[model samples]
Target: MNPPTPSKPSPPSSSSYSSPQTLLALINNILSIVLLSSLTIKSFTGRWQVIHSKLTSLGSSLSSLSSSPHWSENPLLQSLLPSLLSTLQRLSSLSDCCSISSFSGGKLLMQSDLDMASNSLSHSLHDLDLLLRSGVLHQSNAIVLSHPGPCSSKDELSFFIRDLFTRLQIGGIECKTKALESLLQLLSDDEKSASLVAKEGNVGYLIHLLDFNNYGQNSIREHATAALSVLASANDESRKCVFEEGGLGPLLRILETGSMVLKERASAAVEAITADPENAWAVSAYGGVAVLIEACRSGSLVTQTHAVGAIRNVANVEDIKNSLAEEGAVPVLIQVLGSGATSSAQEKAASCLAILASSGEYFRALIVQQRGLQRLMHSMQEVSNSDTLEPVLRAISSLSKLDPSARLLSSSTTFIIQLGEFVKHGNVVLQQISASLLASLSISDGNKRAIGGCMGSLVKLMESPKPVGLQESAAEALVSLLTVRSNRKELVRDEKSVMRLVQMLDPKNEAVYSKKFPVMVVAATVGGGSSHGCRKRLLAAGAHHHLQRLAEMKVAGAHKALQRLSGNRIINTILGRTWRE
Candidate 1:
């Protein structure tokens, strides 16, 4: 029996396998393979990550090197600017593409680094602008630096500008003076740098350098005043800094006592600082307006130019304007307008005169008494630049609004004719002022006759496709001129004049024409008498249709115009309506 049992067990081994143990071994082999593959993948991923980190580090280093001041100084590095900018732009795009998890909890840090790199590339471009200003970079290379950015990141560069100003203030005198001169030259048109310099309390130091006790050399004074001017005009904050740092007193002293160069710079500084009304009154309180007026009257042309600018800055203050006028600024400005001064200087003088004249009727009369109108008209004819013409026209316009001065404009046929010519000028402001002055001058019969010669031009304006504002102004001048019999006779001669006037009675034109039609009311009454031919011309030009339309709409001026046109007894009888008047 034992032999038989052992034979049975040995036979069972060949027919069947151990299913549980075999399956367990198969699972262990599969798991081992999976583990090996995972380890291989992790190793390659880590290596790739290391390479990526190194590339990012390299990029950061390149970005830093590009921002270095020496980067532009070296011709080799300067040549790489376009390439470096390309790389930075790519890095910026990549930074934006990254997910939050990609930075391993340093997403904010990564974004800040990218922003800094972008700004660094931007600041590097300004090196060429700086070099050009310093005469180190040639004009040909300016195109390379002419990218859209120009040190415009004010908040970022503010710290560096503050440091430069600090070094200029506390460092050695000659070195600081040279540094400041360079800075002023570089930043004269850069509002951001000037603002940063003023914000760091460096404006006080700049002003302090104006004193002879601190920086006695005229060169230093000249540089300091120039720097102050840049800072004072940078912004409202810089203007306040100039005011708070006693810049007004020192600038006034320079105006009163400094040399021509110093006075020129100081006058500009004062003008910039006193743009604020408080600062302007402060300068006036310190007797600066009188000195400014004297400067305008007798200084060198450069000095006079700066002085006139300063006067304009303060001319808004009533007391200052009166003081300037009393000190004979009116005559000086009038003379400058007529003289051979540069167009820029003439503009400033005319602007200042306009401000003074705008202050009161007394000022306007004073300017007229000084022959300002004659001088302005002379200058107007000589100059073709609208920059000069605009202010001169504005001054004439302002003066001509007053009854006393309107008479002055009416007395000069040449002036009236000059204004009528200006109505055809390409400048819209000149057109507006010319038209407005013509309307004002037409209040007098003599001026009406003078403006009547421009009847064709006025009719052309009424038919123009120009702005409704200009069309409205022309209509106003026409209505005023037509009140005079000779002016109406002139309009009747121009075939299109009546039609143009009719075109002006549009429902859309009510706002502009409403104020000018009291004269139209008088014209209708006057038309019934000897102005019958003028009335017939108006009717023959299809004015009856527009007048009827306007009357149905209840426009106040339309009814009178309708009644006047309907006063033709034959036409009235044809329409089967009797004359009511």
Candidate 2:
């Protein structure tokens, strides 16, 4: 009866049944929305924050007024109160407009910040341009990587850093020379990004900076010269870019008056440009080799290093190879290895010697005489774990064409054989060079016979889908195998033999097949004229058909094959019969 007392007012109407806890939670949520909206609007629209700040200021003023009887009595303060409170109330209402989503709110604030940053970066970049154009040092120095003022944009900040470097370089002469410290900072990095900037024109500025007239003294030139050394490590294209911009003349001039560091950079710039085949003749045109030769003789390891790389690059010109070799480069290069120099210097010399060996037979004989065989073999023997791959590739390259036959059938020949096997052991570069070395080694009768011992393996290598150079080299070695009369039958007997020979002799392939055409001509007999055993056997294998195709039409390199095929009347009859069909 007591529990039924008043029946709790029939448990209240459903609409009016909300619990005190629920009501309290709803009030708290409403208050939370109000407060969160105020915070959010203030964060996103920075201008909205000004309103918040003014509201806070108005509150402080009201608090100040309450602190003094005179403040309340003051007419000025009295009038300001209504206006201040009215403005704050308006803002509070507006704040309520922004509280729906936290995620959207965050995105909104981020967009605003980015806008501020972009605008700031733009203005800053413009100011930086003005400073650079004015050639005013203090102004330029003021616009640094640091923010001198609130920035325009966040997105372009990094681009701004790059543009500053670009402006410092491309600006008028006064502006560029004024940016020495800046240029040094940018070029100081040898990384690819920094090198991309350098390759664009940094190397040119460095060479220009070291120009004796521009620097005004050897010491200034010397400092610029040192900066150039950092630049040299950037890229081979940068050197070419510098050269194309007319940098070699100034660099060569610096080589005469600059310090060892300067001498090296000048030589390096020279080397970079001349590394391109198109520039080798230009380098020879500019007296580059003579200057590089002097630097190569320098006691400074850096000077000797770049000098060697430069001279080798310049030697790519058939025009300059003899001159480079004659200018004491060969003897000095050979000497640099034994000079107890740094490995880099020795490597540079070894590289130059390798390039020289590619040009003249004299160098080939001389290198073998100088025990280049020993040094080259030693370098090849040790494949270090260094991940710096280029040096290793370069070492392998220098040894790839050493012509071990010229070195006698000593360990180098074994090394070439081992190298051929090694070609199978690695990536594209090693395999291609290994094949190239094998082709060079397999050129003589004995060498061809030696290579013939591995013919089945070479044939296997050729069949595998490998790099073009390796395939080309294997084909070339097979061509070299044709120099021996006894080997021609075996070459003709292989199923894919004629096709490989045709591929080798194809001009469309741009391969070195002109020399092999004569061998194919010699090996191809049509049963009409030559009674040689190999010719008879080759004709027996339908080599006459391949030879008749070459001899009749001069399809690719058939001029010599034409000569041999012309003697065979039966081959002509066979060709006529085939063509008529």
Q: Model 2 — which ten-residue stretch has the worst lDDT?
A: 1-10
Position 456, candidate 1: lDDT: 61
Q: Which ranges in model 2 have alpha carbons more than 4 Å from their true place?
A: 1-179, 189-219, 226-246, 276-282, 337-351, 360-407, 410-413, 416-420, 423-459, 469-581
Question: lDDT, candidate 1, residue 331?
Answer: 83
- Candidate maximizing TM-score: 1
TM-score to native of every candidate shown: 0.63, 0.45
For model 1, the superposed segments whose C-alpha errors exceed 4 Å read 1-159, 188-191, 397-408, 442-453, 456-473, 483-500, 506-537, 552-554, 572-581
TM-score for candidate 2? 0.45
Evaluate residue 108 in candidate 2 and report its C-alpha lDDT on the 0 to 100 scale. 63
lDDT of 1 by residue, 1-581 (tens): 11111111111221243333332233233323322332323222443343344344444444444345443433323233443334344433333344222444464665565555545544444433332223222212321222124745754345345434534543456656765766675565465655666654357778888887675577778888888877777788877888898888988888888888888888777877777777788866788878888887777888887788888778888777778877777887887887767677899888887787677788888888887877876877788888888888888877776776677667777777777777755477777778777776645677667657776676566555556566667667767676777777777767765555665665555433452342262353236347777766665655676678778878666677677777757876644442232
Clashes in each model (backbone N, CA, C under 3 Å)?
Answer: 0, 10
lDDT of 2 by residue, 1-581 (tens): 11211111111222542343332233233333333445555334665454444334434433333444332222222223233223333334445444344434466665565455334433333433433332222222333343312343433333444444455543544444445555456455324434454433345556666656763655546555655544544666554556566766777766656666677667666666566677668766767677778877763776677777777667667768878767767777767766766676666666666666665567776766666655655655543322212233344454444555434432345565555455445455555565665556534455455545455345445544445455556555545555665556565566565455444433344444343433333433222233344443444444445555555554554555545544567655655565567
